[model samples]
Target: MSLKVECQKEELAEALQLASTASRSNSPKFALKSLRLGAESGLITVLGCDGEMWVERDLACEVIESGGVLVDAKFITSLVSAMPSGQVALELLVEDGMRVQQGSAEYKVLSSDPQDFPEPPDFGGEGELTLKFSQLQDALDSVLYAVTTDPHRAILTGVQVSYDGATLKLVATDTHRLAVRTIAQEGMGSSLSVVIPDRALRAIRSLPVGADDDVTIRFGMGRLGVEAGGARVVAQMLSGAYPNWERVVPSEFSRTWQVERDQLIDSLKRAMIIASESANRVKFSGSGDSLVLTAKSEELGEAKEEIPMIADNGQIEVAFNGRYVLDCIQQIRGPGIRFELTESTRPGVIRPAEDGDDYFCVIMPMSLT
Candidate 1:
């Protein structure tokens, strides 16, 4: 069909950008690299999909003809972003081409039949969960970094979402480390859980929804759907059993060291300078009223820094991946951090000095040698 519409350049660009998240520019199939734009009732909806994931956004526009067209996602997004200014008009100038015009500049881009694009499945009706967009974003930030990048372990590449009556928890683990964040959600006593890919959560976090906007979440046909403002993000859910993160989290620790978050972060960064040359292993040992961070590299020399901390159970020595510890502390918003450990070999637990039991990270230890 043909789509004739005029919308602000910024809005068009943003819509295309959202859709481009799922569009595969390098895909061999043209439809997988293309996004469809439909004009109807003073609105232009842009949709893009790569078979598994899809993103759709609606923009208020002047619709002259009710129709649809498919165009290259990357080219269209960049083209609209570079438009001179103000409004950009889109219409079928040829049998198989789209004309984009802004000010005196104009370009006719090749278009494909909208029918060639796979339409996203319909996801409507009341959702199982509803929460503020900011709440979901905050929870996502705390755990996404821990999600595994390994494609082979599809389950570990996703965040485990579980809700039970009063609280919603998000858990992620890459086998080396685990991150968990819980939020207070009133009502809804039923318990449910789902594993959503990290990529999909990242796309949802990128949506330009208001901080106070309400986001609706729905699931169907083994797919998870998130909707907020005029945008919708949907993706296929991962299969197989997720690791029991609860088991990885230490139930009790014999020693706990309370230290300043910023100070430890700085110390780790400096130690990593040398530690990076040695598999990022940084030794943590007791030193009176403070803790010493030491990393030695035959080629890069050694780094040693001491930070004030109170450790219980006399003396403790442990070695961990410096980068892994840094990742956990960066997610801590509080000024203080607590490191809980039973021994050098067991996985150490880290939690913010504040927030009670709301957030924590469990990191596997490295060999001290």
Candidate 2:
């Protein structure tokens, strides 16, 4: 119930904003709506939680008293944000709660009993995987956008993670489209597979970490936790069998086209102007050394554009949701993007033309009709 600390204004505000995402404003437990500020030694820990998720951050500050208390996440976040730049002092003046002071400017705030705050659940400490922060974060950026936002199909709301000790795989799907990213990892003991909520992965992706620093992950006992730099995030794993993602990927795509990445993006954006009237559908007709993209709407008329592309097959035509293709194309790294398909009725695959590219998107085609 008592804690006193002094920290840089900008640093404190940033930490509060990050942790505030986990606070549940409408939770029945008042403590769940607040953040726990614990001062110990020279470190100040700021933590916020709901029952299923939470974010904790460690900030280096001068501690006047080593103790802890629960302060309103929203109020404290805003309070720190509005304070003047420079050192801000926070102290527990009485049982009523804490005081925020910077020079002569002051604010009195009420805090909940620290004992009422639910302790963050422990994620298994064993079988941890440590990999470069950028590697892990880049993998997430490639796949997270495809997870379904529907709550009824909860299993599809998470990314399926599997580590075979040498490779790390992340996959997400919204039924209509699938995004998959994999990275090479080594010395990770034991095999691991679990579905972690997309929201949790996103929360930790931007953690303040050095380029060479590694991110440590632990998954066991129905939970997954991530720690990097001075921040930590944990979430309850979504339970249920993930779809047979491997089977969905085409093992033998007969048609492949290698086209400039920027060209496709530019053409798609232009075509979408007219296609927007027709559910973002863009028709593709690839033949010889050129590819033609066309879109039409009863109200907006029709439009077409063509670009040169080296194709393995003579010709083929298909239809797709332009936005879905754009989402996958934007994530590709190399200049040339490979488009693979067997027929108009089958799923189309979008991948980088560069060898050893571990990211790809499998997009289902819309009816050409």
Candidate 3:
């Protein structure tokens, strides 16, 4: 079928930007097969991707003819992005090829058989949950950093999502540390757990924000799909059992300290500057209402910074990888945070002081010896 379309150049460029980040394959064949087309509400939608992730953008069509086709993603995006700002004509040429013409420049893109491309999984069943865009983005941003990169431990490679009628929790861990963030929601279903790949969560967070519209997440069988802002994301769930994170967190602590978020972050950043050179270790000596951060390297001189803190109970000293602490604090947004500790060797619990029945993070300490 033949069709002509004209739309904003910036819109096409933005679509290409999103698709480019998710396309990591080397072979142009698999990368090009990621484009998809669908018709709805009198608009022609074009989607591009690299199989695991997909992005869809709609352009107004004259509807001289109505059908769907798939073309090489790289060629089409490169051509469209470089085209001059103005109306561009896209037509279906003979022998399964696409013709794009603008001004004096014209390019033909050969398309593959659309029938052979992989289709996104259809999430069946009426079961679904809704979450505000702000809340969902926060949860993803906070916990996704801790997801494991080890492919052999597949379960840790994804964020574990669990929902019970009243609250939804997102947890990620890499054995050494864990991040858990929970947000309150209404109309949730039975308690369900799904391991969503870190890549998929990041893609969802990239959606345009400030829209009051709620994102709908549908889960069934072995897949989870999210629909937000006229776009949809379908991702396969990681097949395995996530570690028992709750058991690893300490139930009781002997010492608790309250510290200013910015102060702690700044201290960690300075400590990491030196610790990063040496095995990335930073020592924390807790006593009374003060904490000392120290780092040393055999080749470089040692550095220490003392920050005032609000501590209860007795004294305890702990050592941790400075990079991990910085990563955890970067996710936390607030004026102050609370840290609970049982001993120098135990995992430390850090949470926002405001306390909204939200989530908390646990960071394991490194052995000093």
Candidate 4:
């Protein structure tokens, strides 16, 4: 027996985009595979993955006949995404494969053994609290930059998620810098800690955006499962405990400065133009009501800029990687930002002055040798 399905072009396109990241080989697997047709609910389960990440989408389909089969995810997705935006029909072919038809265009794609595909990791229990899609996405976007790509330290490779009933905090650090973001949730729940893979978080960002409903995140056993929009994602959680980041963040600072976000970012960019390759160092000197940014390179020329700042403490000077400081500033969402420093050698904290349950970035000072 054969099966037929009709779905919107956009839905298929988005699903393909999310699945493309999961392809394991040089010739990427199809974006749609492991299709299971359910006669009772009129929903078709579409599964795709490479090995590390897996995504599943359930689409409402008019099943002319009740049956199921596996097809290449890449072929189906490419064919559907390239087709004009309209209804597309997928028919099971007798040759142990499937045929996709859109208007005058029709293509046949080979099938993979569905039973060979790895099963998605089971997410045992419901999450502690559900969060809005926008909130989660925004928080991730604000802090993902600080996640370490360095493989030497495994803990810094992923984002640390901490939840304590009232607030959910996501933190990532690379030793040189750290980014911490907090968001408010509705329900009260027990405290939970989980380190989610950076690749999985990036995959979540690619999922259909602007979803009104809350996304369900389940952390149990060694896996984290996220269900949002009409799709679901399952990934293995990073093993081992994250570092004691709180201790690394300085508690008090000798000097605190508040400056415009754009101005600081612009000055850093200009200074970085001539910064040394070995150490993208930029100097920051605080005075009465202004801060000076200076960078000099042996090969290139030196550049300096003076920007007005709201200095509350005594004058101080610190050196840091301009790229790291600019990365933290770019993640900030507001007009004015606060920078608290303890000494020229200690780490400094950068956070928004207004209390809106946002993000905080901490940067370690570099020694000038």
Candidate 5:
């Protein structure tokens, strides 16, 4: 097969970068570390996969001859990115290699048989949900970090997505803490609920979705596909039931406190320094308008900081992993944060002080000794 193409260096590098996301960092199989390049009808498509996840990128280019070739993902991406900002030319050598040339520099990279590259499954299901890029990006940023990294619990490594035409909710938990965010959506005629892997969700979020772009999500053939920003993303769905997060959240709280978001985060960060060697426990006790954050460590001494807050329903004291609290705090956009507790031992619910805000998190209390 013969092929030749010319495209802007920046455009080619971006396309290869997208394809490299699917290529594993270390793989014994050469094909898994490679990306497939194909050209047809004045367009070049790059495909990459690592068995489970796959990516494709298409860009306009001058296609002199149509053919396909498999080239190392990292090598090709790096070569294109280092080239000068202008047209980069690629041609299939007579001896079955790819010749990439730009200006006075030229490199011939070996090409594997394109037929050996596993093709990605076609994704053509009817779009079940349509959400704006901002909304989806917000949801991902708010909850993706909470997904569990423990391989033993596969379900915890995925973000639970539930959409009911108007409201789309994303929830993630790592057993120690849970994050939930809901955003308004439009153009969804039916509801969709699935547990999508954290990696896949991250890939969708990283796509160049314009501020006005609407992402269409589809599910079929035991996989989830996202179409947005002129690209399509597909991944295998996690095959287990996600924990019932709603039930774990406190239904009622005996005490509530409203505190400045910055103040609380700063105090926790200082307290966390002392507890770094320990379990990172930071105790919170509040009465009336006074709140104190305290942490003690056997090897790192102790820390105490008082924060101003508005408390109701009497005094309350709770202990939590300072890191968990900090993680959730960083995601809050409002100036004030509201934390509610049923008891010191029960999980505490945190939300933005802004009423009717749909973002919240639950932190399981750490043991106090």
Candidate 6:
């Protein structure tokens, strides 16, 4: 028996986009690089995985027959994307392989054993929370940079996704710095928390979620799953407790300065060019109504920028990893960026300079030397 399904070329293209990232093209396990297609009553589901990340996207189509096939993700994706904006048909070959056809063009591609594909983890509970796509994506963009890239520090490579009764929060830290953002939403009445690999969080962004749509998150059976935008994603939870990031955030402030967001970023970028070759450190000195940014190197030279500021308190001097400050300010969209400092020895926060905002970053100060 052969599996068959017919779908619009654009529909197939969209579905392929959602599943393509799960392919590990260089993996020794060929099945891991393939897309698993399962056709049932009236819909066709495409599944892809790269061991750590997985995506399952459903495409609306006419299922001429009900069956399944696993084909190379790259090959199928290329074939589908090149097809005309019309209908396309996919069918399993008589003896082996699968065939894809559009108009006069056709291609037969080798297949993998469907059973060899690893299944997505079973997420059993009712959805725990629902968040708008923009909300989650916004928070992810702000905090993901702080996720550590060190392989040995596996726990720091994942973001802590948590929800209290009223807020959904994402927190990530790399010991040197921390990022936290909490968005107000209503969904699950109780609290829920999970540490999800940054890789998996990236895969969720690739799933077809639109900026305005809502994404539903469910947790159970040692897995976390999200359903939205015609796709469902489930991944195994990273096995470790995230650090207590709250303790690292400085609660009291000795000085706070408000500066134009674009101006600060521009000044930092110019300073970064010189700092990158040296210590990657940028020092901030705030006194009276102006903040001066200075970076120096023995080999490359130094850069000095004076930015107008509204310092609320004491004269302060602090040095921080310039890249860290850039990362935090780049995510903030408001007109003004706020810098709250307790001392040159503690972490300083960069946040939108508005009355209230959902995002904030705690960057540790570096020594001038």
Best by TM-score: 1
User: Which 10 consecutive positions of candidate 3 have the poorest summed lDDT?
Assistant: 31-40
Candidate 2 matches the true fold with a TM-score of: 0.88
Candidate 1 clashing pairs, residues 3+ apart or interchain: none
RMSD of each: 2.5, 2.8, 3.5, 3.9, 2.8, 3.2
Candidate 6 residue lDDT tens string, 127-210: 376767787788889899999999999999899988878888899999999988878876643588889888778878776768
Q: Order the numbered candidates by lDDT, best leading.
A: 2, 1, 5, 6, 4, 3
TM-score of 3: 0.83
**lDDT for predicted candidate 5 compared with the true structure:** 0.86
lDDT by residue (158-231, candidate 4, tens digit) is 99988988788999998888889988764835578889888788887766647565776777777778777677
lDDT of 2 by residue, 193-302 (tens): 88998778877786888867877888777887887778888888899999998888888888888899999999999999999999999999988999899999999899
- Which residues of candidate 6, in runs, are more than 4 Å off? 1-10, 40-42, 51-53, 62-66, 74-108, 185-188, 296-301
Q: Write candidate 3's Cα lDDT for 215-269 as tens digits.
A: 8778786777776665667767788888889999888888887888899998889
Which ten-residue region of model 5 has the weakest summed lDDT?
Answer: 123-132
Which pairs of residues collide in candidate 5?
none
Q: Between candidates 3 and 4, which one is better according to TM-score?
A: 3
Q: lDDT values of the candidates?
A: 0.88, 0.88, 0.74, 0.76, 0.86, 0.85
- Cα TM-score per model: 0.90, 0.88, 0.83, 0.81, 0.88, 0.85
TM-score of 1: 0.90
Query: Which of candidates 1 and 5 reaches a greater lDDT?
Result: 1
Q: What is the Å distance of residue 149 in model 4 from its true position?
A: 2.0
Which of candidates 1 and 2 is the stronger one according to TM-score?
1
How far is 91's C-alpha from truth in model 6 (Å)? 5.2
lDDT against true structure, model 2: 0.88
lDDT of 1 by residue, 1-369 (tens): 777888988888989998899989999999999999888999999999999899999989999998988899999999998876698899986574999988888888998889998877765433366778888788899999999999888899999988887899999999999999998877633466889988788889988899998776787678888877788898988888888778778888888788999999999999999999999999999867899999999997999999999778738899999998998899898999988899899999999977749999999999999
- Superior candidate under lDDT, 2 versus 6: 2
Off by over 4 Å in 1: 64-66, 82-85, 103-108, 123-127, 188-190, 296-300
